[model samples]
Target: MIALLSAPSNLGLRPPQRGSVPGVSKAPEALREAGLFRRLLDDGATDAGVVLAGRYIDDDDARAPGHVRNEEALVDHARRLADRLTSILDAGDAPLVIGGDCSLLLGIGVALARRGGAGLVHVDGHTDFRHPGNSDECASVAGEDLAAATGLHWPAIADIDGLAPYFAPQRAVHIGHRDDDEELEEVRGIIGLVVSAADAAVAASDDLAASVVETAGTGYWLQIDVDVLDPEVMPAVDSPDPGGLGVPELTELLRRLAPRAIGASVTVFDPDLDPDGRFARLLADVVVDALRTLGTAV
Candidate 1:
């Protein structure tokens, strides 16, 4: 059985109004209001071959008042969420977590790490490897999430009790980056941190199954960021950069990757960035694609 979960971030630390992003309105609310949620739920419920459960996590990072922005609070929340996911998995249901921010990956990673070593296939435009020191450069909460999982910003994620560094460098694989960087030092440091963006570009294509099997090797988790797509296709993100994978490319990639991994969870952020709600629908589609892919394998 597969479960569909929505970790909607519209409640916390996000711009409440629509039109916050250019040429778009109702993006954040759409996550809550649009038919996408119901559609995903329906797909799960009606798919006889697969049992699906649906729900939404009501808490947001800002629920703690200044906590959402704090790394430790985020980590604690991640741990709690991880516990929830573990419970679901223990009950014999696979959890598919939606998101308010990418920080949710910390929880997912922590849970997977507890089970044993788990590889990560991260597809995003930015490296998200910023240590606490790098926070001074880009202060966006979503920006430092992947770093926190690596124990980079200990203060933010240290609150989670007994949780250790989720995965080592070799266990992690990143794809999709086209933005040029002036921080050559940091860029050079991430040489091994990233896989071939060229490969990521075509990763969602027909051979995605083989690609995922090769990367997953033994066992793995999938982490996706919508910003990994071109802004033209995914402009609702707070930090949408130009020149990345297209929607079909990334969706196809997830379709290929899902079945090979031991477990999988996706982080869908910047729902507020999507105005027409097409982006949210698109996110749901990618998730469904993964589920369908898993179904085929099962």
Candidate 2:
């Protein structure tokens, strides 16, 4: 069985404008309105409900080396979100987390860390490897989540509960990053493997899945940032760049890997960009088409 969990937190992102919040905070409900919740329920997924987030302070940008935007609120949300995921996992169900932003990985990291350990499969358009070590502009955790999840960031966000490096670098695999990703070399060197979207275009889908699954070991957590899709297909993300995958490619990859994952998170979909809600329906369709097989192996 699968458990649908919502973590509607936008604390990790910078504001769209000085006084406005990121509409990513409304993703869970947008997806719900698109009938994802109802469709998943009909497909045997249980609704675990929403994990509300803290206020998104536009001025919360903390570039003070060791601090991140929405420091306390982000930490608090991660812990509470972990509690919800832990409960779902404890019940022998695979969690399909609807996220507000990529920073929700912090909470998912906490959940996996507490229960022994697990590998990670990160699918995003960018490497998301900015950290205090490499750069001082590490204010938005949404842009630096992969680095923080691997314990490469400051102790404040990385070493939560004294369980740093939620997913070991050697056991983590990255796929679907763009060919022009700035941090490609660094992330590939640190993470177990990195498959560029260009590589996935030529290689077999199952082969890509095998590489990630083999390197990530078993019971890996799957992180899918929708920016991995072509901006023409999914321009409703916080960051949409060129050189991303198509819908068929994404669905094929998900079908091959999702059933093997212990849990999964979907992030970076902004309802504000999707005014007419067509993108929401498109996203929901893709998820159900490819990820209905989630938890089949577990």
Top lDDT model: 2
lDDT of each prediction vs. the true structure?
A: 0.55, 0.90
lDDT of 2 by residue, 1-298 (tens): 9899999889988888887889998999999999988999998899998899898887644445468888889999999998998999999999999989999999999999999889999998888899987885778999999999999998889989998999999998888887777788889789998888888867898788889878997689999999999999999998899999999999889988998899899998999999999999999998988889886875
Q: After superposition, how far is residue 141 of candidate 1 from its true place, in Å?
A: 4.3
CA-only RMSD, every prediction:
6.0, 1.2
User: Alpha-carbon error at 110 in model 1, in Å?
Assistant: 2.2
Task: Record all residue pairs in model 2 with backbone atoms less than 3 Å apart, i.e. clashing.
Answer: none
**Candidate 2 error regions (>4 Å):** 60-65
TM-score of 2: 0.97
Q: Each prediction's TM-score against the native?
A: 0.74, 0.97
lDDT of 1: 0.55
Residue range 1-298, candidate 1, lDDT tens digits:
5565545432213333322322112332354465544665666622112111122223343345434343445545566767776776566555555555566677776786777657677777777666556545433346665665655555556334555567655556667766463332463464334544555675436565455455445456667776787888777675677777777777767776666555555554554455466777776666566554342342
